[model samples]
Target chain A: MQQNEENDNPPLFKSWKGMYWLVLGALIFQIILYYAITRYFE
Target chain B: MSYIDWFVLLGTVVFITVYGIWKTRGTQNIEGYLKGNNSEKWWTICLSIMATQASAITFLSTPGQAYEDGMRFLQFYFGLPIAMVIICVTFIPIYYKLKVYTAYEFLESRFDLKTRSLAAFLFLVQRGLAAGITIYAPAIILSTILGWNINLTNICVGALVIAYTVSGGTKAVSATQKQQMAVMMGGMIIAGIVVVHMLPAQVSFGDAVQVAGEMGKLNLVNFDFSWTDRYNVWSGVTAGLFLFMSYFGTDQSQVARYLSGKSISEIRTGLLFNGLLKIPMQFIILFIGVMVFVFYQFVQPPLYFNKVETDKLANTEQAAQFRELEVKHQQNFQAKSEQVQVMVNALQAGNDTNVETARQSLNSIQEEGKSIRKEVKDLLKKANPNTEARDTDYVFISFVMQYMPVGLIGLLMAVIICAAMSSTSSELNALASTSLIDIYRRSVKKEASEKHYLNMSRLLTFAWGVLAIFFATLASRMENLIQAVNILGSIFYGTILGIFVVAFYFKYVKSNAVFWAAVLAELIVIATYVQTDIGFLWLNPIGCLLVIFFGFMFQVLFGRKLEPVEIGIEKPLKSGK
Candidate 1:
């Protein structure tokens, strides 16, 4: 089936855990910057 | 503006409409009318999807958004690429496998007719209002800037879209969007460049960025975990993901874009293209606002950019207060302008301490101006009590009208108009498709000929177009263009996305479970939205999860499997009289 063809291909993304961590890190960094600007800088 | 600029504006519209209609002449069958016969290549689908998402508000308000809130709004899209991957893996293949024209068509197969109707109805209500806003947003900008009648602008914009859409259907919509996207991108790039060029000779691009950064306008990321904070990291990931999933994954306006692809791979490629391009495109657009912020630091801008409100205020007794505020604004601008120049020189000379001092000074002055504007608006409201106040939404339109060169001004206007039309035409087409296929064809007339359906579709398309225009006239009272449309979407998309998710993965949950769960979830979502003041984006995830969670519980308690409902995909089980 054509659905299986998608499975045969290397997934568009892999390692959901790693992906989650990467996004988390970016989010953390962004929040830190937001804090610096809003709460601390001025 | 010069006569040539008006000529350019009118010429672009007439030429593009004639071009799209001439190219997409034949839309004979329902498939052709709805999905463009699945004949479109990847790029056409890509452009169509991009154009659909990039409504008029994105152009007119995004820069103003950045001007007010900084670039943190870009974080709201951090989850977009991830959502695209999820949709590609799960949603795309299922819809392709089903060969469904509308996304809700699969709901009946997996659950019941009520579930399908429920999902489809949610989409129609959300998308229909969104279409109104899409048309209304750009028309408001044009009417405010050009001093044209708002009603006339709404009707003209709505009628122009219905003409091409009713004539050529989805094929015309897709084909025209490719050109619209091209024109929009080109016009925006030109505008950005011209904004930089029009900046005072002393301020270079680097200098502008530095000034903007100092003023806290270059802030692009926010990692805060607060649920109520609209554009923070947590909201962007959790809530924003659900919004994107529902918007791209299940909404027929978007699904229909990919449904027109020549092959499954083409659709996947189209979606992936959007996934990769959407964030960067938004960043660039918002960055234009960042640049506008820097530009305004050098130039004296209007105290309130919305002409209608400003005009009314001018005639009021508060005019003196407003004039005083403008004088204070100019004085503050002058002070900040000198500091920016000094900072630029210091940065060039590698004096970090001087740059830091200059940055602090600029930031403090900006805050002072903001506080002063707030006081001024309060004073105005206090004076008149019923006068319209707040005009941050008018900043970008005011900038274009005041600064952009002649022909380019017209082109920028065309870009916005094209965005309005591009999104509205798709909505009108999708609304008509759902109305006919999900409601009329399935429930009202099951054995209609292809010709009958085609005529009915066109008629429905025209009817919805007029309905949107009527709604657009009423949408004038809504505050914040992007937030208003999104609030409308968040009210519905989550429930619809949940229905599809359950159909795809929650196999044990029976039809009755999902149907009742969806109804209950929708009621809960609406009630929660009304009762709370949480950020609108979070509602998307909350709505979807509520339905999924409730559906499981409903099935566990019911014991007996619910009857699966048919949705007229096959021959009628019992012939109608």
Candidate 2:
């Protein structure tokens, strides 16, 4: 019952899980960018 | 340091302290003192969490780390976002639903009293020592560079943190962190700009970055998986994940930061904010170091960045040899400067072959300079074995003193001091909370009134502050301040993390089995640290896995009746009793 109430209705994302996924995606994006920076500079 | 620098440093630090005390003036009860009356919004929690994690060492030593070792250290945080997600999903709701003050209070409901006590004991020990490092790290460095007495600096830093922390407790810590985080990041950004601007007029910021990249300072990620390598992608994502989970999930200093949130959603948002911003913030600071590295390419840097030790060497019989090495160092610097210029020109001309050639030449020059520096270190060590010959901690401060404008120098110094105060205040506040909640109030004086407990909290905060100051006075040089703290945390974090993981998941594993398993796992983890070549990050996962593995084995071996406890997500208060 408490869990149901605490399910955050994020303003941008539809669900809390979606926000987590977005954060994970952002991390991946950063990693890919860093990789590109490394390869381009190397 | 000039008068402007002094005024900026003192003014910024004094204002923050007074503001923290004034803003959190009233706390008549234990709950208000320990948990800030649950009045914090997401932003305060976010900044408080960030400030707690980033110590003065982060400011003083990280740029120096980038200067010496490059930005690969950024990989250390790769697992943090995932850890934040895990904590938000698993840890936060449980803590909030339980309405627990310290994270250990949840352990008691899930397991038993001994289990909770053991976890709390581990936290107090590790964090107590860490509090010392947080205070000592910047105090020693600031004093050495600015010609202040180290003892006095430690007291001053410790005293300021104690003032607001003892007065306002968690509210004070959270209130001041908002401003400290502002000054810290703002100062760092300003320093970054000034570093790039200090570069020769011909070198654009892009050219400076290209130079740093060519010299291999921009190696941010390595996909190569090695068990022994500390900052590779695999260890970072795997071991780093476990470490961050333990730090955010179990460490009271961190737990207390978010536990003050007005709601579970606020805590989640605050943590996710940290997860997203922390990496970019680290990247910026490291890039500042990279820029500092590039700045030194055109302008000659000392053979040894630690001038005190080098100056002492000048007075020794090794003075002649040091002078000879200095000449060689000067010549190497000239060659490296020319090669760097060639690399810059090649980069500007868009000639890949010349760029590669010049980059290789510059790398060789750097290698030669390193050899000379190593010899200088050897000579310094021979002159006095007690000397801290490692100068990486001094690099950034040396740059600030030598090159930065006067007012900015003070502001940067204020940045370091504020970082120290912010982190130390949180640690002291957490220490006092855990001591009072987990130990003193729970065990020693269980029937104390609300007013009595509040007074005890204030007393414990002051006691911990003094203990930290005492440890700071006795502390010596570490190889790198940031890594030293992390290594210390990793040593104990894994074991604590394991206990929490078992409590949250393994319902059949009773308190006795987990209690003993944690003890054995902690011993084995310590043994592994003392005996093996395993990277410190791996210790987190290792200790965690050891406990889970041992927990199941011990439970079956002991033939304890498997009374499955209800580990459901019902309102924790209703579920626990």
Give the per-residue lDDT of model 1 (tens digit) for B115-143. 87888887888788888888887887788
Off by over 4 Å in 2: A1-7, B476-486, B568-577
Tell me the tens digit of each residue's lDDT in model 2 across B314-412: 788999999999999999999999999888888899999999899878888889988999999999989998676888889999999999998999999
- Please state the Cα-based DockQ of model 1 relative to the true two-chain complex: 0.13
Error of model 2, residue B553, in angstroms: 1.3
Model 2 chain B: weakest 10-residue lDDT segment is B568-577
* Residue-by-residue lDDT tens digits, candidate 2, A1-42: 122335455546777888788778888988999989988777
**Residue B466 deviation, candidate 2, in Å?**
1.2
lDDT assessment of candidate 2? 0.88
Q: Which candidate tops DockQ? A: 2
Chain A TM-scores for all candidates read 0.52, 0.74
